[model samples]
Target: MYYTIGEVANATGIAISTLRYYDREGMFPDMERSSGGIRVFSDKELGTLKVVECLKHAGMSIKDIKEFLGWCQEGDATLPQRRRMFHDRLAEVERQMDELRNTMNLLRYKCWYYDTAVAAGTEDAVRDLPDEDVPEDLRDYRI
Candidate 1:
């Protein structure tokens, strides 16, 4: 079904301006215009938007996304390129997952340490960690 920008935003949980920007950026499927120049989106456009959102969430940059869209415009000739893109994205995602898991583990250990310290009546246990003992970038992550 076709939907107005507002309806599409509600359905996709993306901002109306984001949808408009995606259209303007050519990351969206071909869009049709109303008699008065308003944009109308079809089911295909909505599906494409969903895929775009997923790609963005997976850490694909807008520049690469536009390049991917350009490859898409090339039709069957671009399948190999698309496959390579997905392969690269998969590796990147795996690396991010590992980093996230490590961060979560660090946070969990810190929480456990604080909990134990609070129960033991030694708040300083949590507070006395030396800066050198903690990671440089991670110092900002602590509460």
Candidate 2:
């Protein structure tokens, strides 16, 4: 099935201008144009746009995605390069997750500290908590 540029934008929830920008960026190599010179999107083109959105959201730069897509068009010869790109993205995502986890842990520890102090009606009580009284994982976060 074919869809107009507006229809593709509506279906993908991306702005029409952004779609036009992507097209201008050579992201739609297989795109077809009507006899009147109007661009029309096929389902396959829509699928490619979805992938571009995914890679964009995954923190890949447009230049990098373009390079990756170029590699894709080169067929089996680029398999190793594609694999390495994904592996690199995975490591970066994992690193981000770890940083977020650490942030959450610190927030949790702060919450517990404040709650304990409020319950005892004094910050002094929480401050003097013995090592054994604190959560094992939060011990390092004690301030």
Candidate 3:
């Protein structure tokens, strides 16, 4: 079924402005316009937007997603490129997950340290640290 831009935005929880921006970026070249020239979206277009949301949630840049769409439009000629993109994104996601796990461990350790210091009445043992002491593994996990 077809849907208006507003409807699609409401259903997907994506801002209508962002959907329009994606359309302008050639992510949905087959998108139709209504008789009054408002954007009209097909189910396929909505599906594409959902994929875009997933990619964004995975920390992908708009440029990378645009390139992916370009390769998608070129069909089999860019299948290898598409595969490589997917592989890269997968590797990045795995690294992010590892870092998050490490960070959680560090935070737990820090909390335990603080609790023990308080219980033992030994503030010096709390080991005040610069934020940088958070290991390299978790440094780049900022949201």
Candidate 4:
């Protein structure tokens, strides 16, 4: 079934103007228009919107996504380029995950340090802890 622009915007959590912008950018190359030239989104358009959003969230630029879409239209001949692009995205995501993990580790260590200092009634107890005195898991995780 076809849905109006409002329904598509609501379902996709995208602003109507952004949808129009995506259309202007040729993001939805095959999306339909009604007799009145109103946008009418079908499941295909919805699925494509979801994909565009995912790629955007994953650090792919609109230009790269447009290129990716063009690659799709080129059929199996472009498969290697698409695969390489995704592999690059995966590496970047992995780097981001590692940075987050390090941040969490620092936060965890801070929590432990504060808890120890609070119990001792002063920061003195934890401020200059020796390497051997710190918890093994937190020893290397200080700020």
Candidate 5:
């Protein structure tokens, strides 16, 4: 079934203007237009929009995404290049995940620090605790 641009926007949770900009940027190369110049989107196009959203969330630049879309249009001949692109993206994502995990660990340590301080009614009390009493994962963060 075909959907109007407004319908596509509602379904995808993307702003209508952004979707229009994507169309203008050649992100929707296979999109159809009515004789009267209205854009027509198919259900299949919704899946394409989901991929665009995922790639954008993964930190791909619009120009790079456009290039990837162009590669997509080239069919199986571009499979190796597309695989490498995804592999590179995967590496970046893994690096981001590692950074986030480190941040989370620090946050957890701070939470424990504050909680201990609250229990003792003074930050100094928690700060005086021995290193052996600290969680191993948080030992490096000890006061």
Candidate 6:
């Protein structure tokens, strides 16, 4: 269905100005325009914007996304390049996942430490706990 720029922004939860900037940047290659210069969007273009948002969330720079969009416009000849980009992004996401997991582990240990201190009515009580009594997962995070 045809939609105005405002409708697209509301549907996608992106600012109208940002959508206009993206249009200015040629991110929406197939977007149409009225004779008076108003931007028009279609459902397909909205889907494309959603993908652009996802790539931005995945840490891709606008320049890189523009380049990727260029490759897309180039069609089948750029398939391998697009595949490599996705593969590299996947590896980076995996690294971020590992870091997040480590952070979560540390936070969990801190929660347990504070909970024990609360139960015993003193931080010193938690600090004085025997090493063998500590959780195995939190051993490395022990003070």
**Best to worst by TM-score, what's the order?**
6, 5, 4, 2, 1, 3
Candidate 3 or 2, higher TM-score: 2
- Model 6 ranges with Cα > 4 A deviation: none
- What lDDT would each prediction earn against the true structure? 0.83, 0.92, 0.81, 0.91, 0.90, 0.89
Candidate 3 residues lying further than 4 Å off, grouped into runs, are: 119-143
Candidate 2 regions with alpha-carbon error over 4 angstroms: none
Structure candidate 4, residue pairs in collision: none
> Against the correct fold, how does model 3 do in TM-score?
0.78
- Over 1-143, each residue of candidate 3 has an lDDT whose tens digit, in order, gives 99988888888888989988999999998898988999889988978888888888889999989988888888999999989888888899999999998888777666666675798699564456444654455444322
Model number with the top lDDT: 2
- Among residues 3 or more apart in sequence or in different chains, the pairs in candidate 1 whose N, CA or C atoms overlap within 3 Å are none
Model 5: CA > 4 A from native: 140-143
Compute each candidate's TM-score over C-alphas. 0.82, 0.83, 0.78, 0.90, 0.91, 0.92
lDDT of 2 by residue, 1-143 (tens): 99999998888899999999998999989899999988899988888898899889789999999999899899999999999998998899889899999899999999999999999999999898899999999988777
47-105: candidate 6 lDDT, tens digit per residue: 88887998898889999999999999999999999999999988988899999998988
Sort all candidates by lDDT, best to worst: 2, 4, 5, 6, 1, 3
In model 5, what lDDT does residue 56 have? 96
CA error at residue 82 for candidate 1, angstroms: 0.3
Clash totals in order: 0, 0, 0, 0, 0, 0
Q: For model 2, which pairs clash? A: none
Compared with the true structure, what per-residue lDDT tens digits does model 5 show for residues 1-143? 99999998887789999999999998888899999999999876787888889999899999999999999999999999999999999999999999999888888889999998899899988777888888888987654
Which candidate, 4 or 5, would have the higher TM-score against the true structure?
5
Worst 10 residues of 3 by lDDT: 134-143
Greater-lDDT candidate between 2 and 3? 2
